[model samples]
Target: MVISRRGLLQAGIGWLPWRAMPRLTMQLDWHLNAQFAGLCVAESLGYYRRAGLVVNLKAAEPAMDVVQTVVAQPQTLGCAEESLILTAQSEGIDIVAIAAMLQASPLALMSLPQQSLTHPRQLIGKRIGVHSDGRKAVELVLYSHNIDPQQLDLVDIPYDKKYQRLSQGEFDAVQCYALDEPIEFAQRSGQVPTVLPLKDYGFDAYSQVIFAPTSLVMDQPQNIQHFLSATFAGWRWAIEHPSTTANLLVEQYVEPDYQNIAYQQASLEILADYVLPKDAPRLGIIDARRWHESAKQLQQAGLIAALPPMAMSVNDNLWP
Candidate 1:
């Protein structure tokens, strides 16, 4: 008998039975951008279905409230910045990071060629654009380099407008994912925006964490493990065969955009440095020390009131 992904998940996680195992839904934090290329690969490659998960990939609205949405649907899992998870947990939301979809923070500051802002400290006195969700990451980066947020003016700009605004000189720089906007802008204008990576500045935080309610994890540990294991395998595969994965993304998910395929392939190569660290356990391994350090940095930057104990937020069973 061929067992379905859901059946295996139910068996592994000790769900009541195949009939009792409910379908799982996931909420992503953004549009179908390259940052989520692995998810696209997983979906196209049959990873989610093989794991018995029925994922509903929703379009994220500008005003979407991530915490409220997750709280309302207790069984639903939501992906967002790790700082948001810490913020939610600090507010007693009971969310735990089950798997880290992105092992490194993608947040960075991008500047036009004329500005030549090569370092975080140089961002002082410049008009910076950042999404409200990205404020904590930017603050952490600034704090790590001893740059005072008060010295700089922050403009709350929608992510879509960031590159254009920068091109038009609306802001001196914009905080965005190194993997997406900078590449997109460069492709469109043939001018590569200078990027200052936050991780390089010691404000290391996890981006794109896969999180669900604490009760859900406690009740279905094995299911969570299976989901993460397959998900990690999907990422590893995506990284190994980026062109093929990008082709899958363009073909299966939507009409082929050859430009996007090229962009995604490049982004995947750059992401390899972030996702797979040498001497670490392996790809997608969630480190407790890294989590604690990130939480502490957020606290120090005043993004969170307090750091939740590392034991409370990170679950290591997802790592192979």
Candidate 2:
């Protein structure tokens, strides 16, 4: 199964009662966590309110398909991996990307630093834990390294158990979101795991992107733009003040006792590398060339039959 089948994100943060406010439901690509702090902060800080909108941020479940949800409810907007956007288009899902949430892909291979599993080639005979949705990326990494994926011992592990099992030596290495899982394990355990980002090995693809049905783009262009503007502002603020954002998140949005505020700050700090790279175009702006290249990578991994046609793959004009 692809990551789309494994999990998606959403969080029903809050809703305003005003009859005139445009209420939009946002479907996230994965469960709520520090990764979605910007969205949560946007709501808490009144960024959405200032935009004349009331957004319902819905957290995704392992069984729910974001594309299906967005398709069934065209008025809704959703976030997911860039490859999913291409795949959805190939399958006739008609979704258009609004902006890239993570400018750099966060997909990574993690292992104990002592194992020396620092490079893709080192895993030829080693057992590597992978999420069902992560198979294509693992394969792409292998191919990029001139190693056949068949040479690697790939084990399909559930998302929640990948790190735990890795710590127990169940897997020599495991795939994970570079920004979140490694920090999570480091916080829980004194040991820090070594990470080999797939992007470093040429399997880069956008991790989280905000998108909506094509009809929504055409019918309510202003709403989509407003949401993006407010979202970008929220992310800028979140990155600048992770500690404060984390506190706000735990207080109202995230589970107060379940998620530690400090841990949330740590994850967001690491995420700055992806969310706001040193010299990117700007926050939430999609790079057209990278978008096309990602489609090619998807095709190379055999996840998609072919690269999506330019017309169907991206709308560069959507962001500005």
Candidate 3:
């Protein structure tokens, strides 16, 4: 049975059929959108079912702490940025990243033509509206360009309302998803915005990471393996068929005005670049070097006290 809020709170693993197969729940870091195309495709195409598993896919809510939820709930999984996993790990949260979904982070700093902030250094003396969760990323970007964080004006904007404020001139720039806000703004305003992608600015990190309680990894290795294989296979299919997957995302998952189809397609195409970059070893392979670099960037930015043990932060063997 599909697990909703009420169902998840009440249902127990004992509620499953008396088979030994494991029942699991997956929590996404954000709301349903093209970003979750792979998981949605996996669900719609019966990949999860074929693996002899029952899964509950939970969409994100405001102020929802996904990692903490995984820690609090048993037999559950979560997807979030590796930076968050690292930070939580440093704070003594026992979690291990199993697979890297997006090869590069889509987090970006966006501004319209009037702002004319062409370079990262130009951010100084300007107000940048950012989500509190994204402060570390924005910090890394500023420091990478030798710009001191104190030199810029940072106003915390609710993640949901950033675009509205940026459009109304409340912010000279805002942190947002490259695939999402830029396209949405262009579609609405007919003017392309300047997008400074964090990855290009040396804030590279894997995004939409699949992570689980270390207990879950050790206790249910086979279940995790099956889930990864099927999930990555679903991603492969989604990447190969962006338009088809986008249609499924809008119709069955998050409904949008039919006119938004073009915007959806554009977002999917941009996501494909991050999900399947040139010479990527495989669709869902996590780069050990990139992870190390990500950790180093976080440490330099003072987000984490220091680098957590690599073995503790990631366990990529499960993906293969």
The prediction achieving the highest TM-score against the true structure is 3
C-alpha RMSD in Å of predicted model 1 compared with the true structure: 4.4
The TM-score between candidate 3 and the true structure equals: 0.88
Where does the lowest 10-residue lDDT sum fall in candidate 1? 1-10
Residue 143, candidate 2: alpha-carbon lDDT? 79
Cα lDDT tens digits, model 3, 227-250, are 776687778888889888877887
Off by over 4 Å in 2: 1-17, 256-258, 311-320
Better of 2 and 3 by TM-score: 3
- Cα displacement (angstroms), candidate 2, residue 219, comes to 1.5
Better of 2 and 3 by lDDT: 3
Provide the clashing-pair count of each candidate structure.
4, 14, 0
Task: Report the lDDT of model 2 for residue 272.
Answer: 85
- Candidate closest to the true structure, highest lDDT: 3
